[model samples]
Target: MNSLKRIMVGLDLSEMDETLIRYTAFLCSISEIERVYFIHAEKSLDIPDEVLESMPNGMPADEKLRASLIEKVESYFGPDSRVQVDVQVVEGSPLKELLHWSKVKQIDLILAGRKFHMRGSGVLAQKLLRTGRVSVLFVPENIEPRLNHIVVSVDFSEYSLMALDRILDSALTRPEVRITCMHAYEVPTGYITLGISYEDFDERMKGFARNKFAQVLERFPELNDRATLHLVKQENEDDIGELVMVEAKRLKADMLVIGAKGKSAAALFVLGSVTEKILRYNDDVPMIVYKKENEEIGFLDALLGND
Candidate 1:
């Protein structure tokens, strides 16, 4: 619903990829999607050398693979569906090719599988997160789709506001949709740290959180009538990622939304922490990461060079 007319599904040519493609097709069936691209990114070495010995056979093998993948997709969607789908095979890194094709083809949404064991701090996932051009939906293996309850994390940042606005504007928000907006506050403790009293710090933090919640509700009056607000106080936990996952599981939330800072290419390649932690431990629920855009920055932010 967020101008997502074109969707690109990243496929790995495996059973899991097939499941992801089918799940994506199911989601698109209910939307105004005009086209679906089934993209398979393969390493150049995967192409058989014997087939490549002759230029004609090399092209034939690639064409055959494409046709097979297309056939599988069509079969899963059934013959009655009117969604137009095309198959593409590219040679490069999977994430790189997906991002490049999404931009070049003007894709609005990207649907990809979430790897469970491949959960270490990786650059590929971070790169996809920083791609502000398209909205990404990660489908975890063996998880069914649910649109009943959603949990959105807010910290009074413009990125959080933008994410909340987008979710409210999407098709996911219907009369049956139940949304919970959560704000987590942490109180610093321990003698090894600063000498500030933990109790006093907690009280101040709670007051600040309450005021911020009121301001957020006032700024977006439409959400006041639709979503419920919840404030969580944590004294020992510092990792917001872990807290968010635990709370989502406790509430049985179908999805989680967070505001993320876009990291530079070099930083991402070296160590991707935030997204990696979330994806590794919270594979049950989908996450929608929102990054701040230039248009959302105010004059004050521009003066401070925060934009």
Candidate 2:
């Protein structure tokens, strides 16, 4: 949000790797990203013995692969890149290497491409989403690198508020861009067991949800001028994540931004239940996952606290 100064983009040799680079380029063109680290994590350093035998005896297999990958990525950007590009090649699990590099280098954002057909890539992405410390932007294949409209999912919780704040603080929510602050709500299933008619409960729940949405908007008065508020009511069999995707499609949003509720049991229920499902859905819309920070209590507060 604070104009990402450093970004690390994860790349594989697959065709989608270029898509990640182009996405990074698109962001850099619009924001203040200063340095871009393009990284490829090779699963192993070992090469086939037959191929190794053909190469010079003194050459290292890892070094050869590194040089080749660097050249290939460089070809995509050529020499006239608007931002500083640094190509890096390493050997390890992709998730592990990406997490380590981002943390050690103080990366502000991470960019990666999602392959619809690759189940393994999806698993790796989920692992990164859970384990990585930095914000990640997952760009699906064939997505246009534009930011005309963005949908930020909100539950009126601190974590969702954090996501909205990040988008507002950035240049992404400019005047030309249409921003939608969307919240999805559903009545408790127990209402049916308690003899409440579904229709009766739904109407009551929707009224409550509308009031909550109004309260949330009241807190951010400027949003009234810059964004639109949308409240979605979930049906009996609807999942929250599915509802979010349906809203995105209905709104024709170019991007989706949502916050992870951190690892606390209560927080996990919010992010893990919905955001995790959305990640698996892979609807071809780009998404930014913002993780909530661990709020550290002050010394004065700690001393006076009663748990």
What TM-scores do the predictions have?
0.78, 0.81
Highest lDDT against the true fold, candidate: 2
Model 1 residue runs over 4 Å out of place are 49-59, 117-127, 130-133, 188-204, 270-273, 292-307
Model 1 Cα lDDT, one tens digit per residue, 53-91: 534443565675676687788776766777777789878
> For model 1, what is the alpha-carbon lDDT of residue 282?
75
TM-score of candidate 2 against the unseen true structure: 0.81
lDDT by residue (208-298, candidate 2, tens digit) is 7677767767877767776777878877787777778878988998999998754533342244467788876756899999875432223
**Worst 10-residue lDDT window, candidate 1:** 295-304
RMSD (CA, Å), candidate 2 to true, equals: 6.1
lDDT of 2: 0.75
Q: RMSD, model 1, all Cα superposed?
A: 6.3
Q: How does residue 273 of candidate 2 score in lDDT?
A: 60
For residue 59, model 1's alpha carbon misses the true position, in angstroms, by 7.4
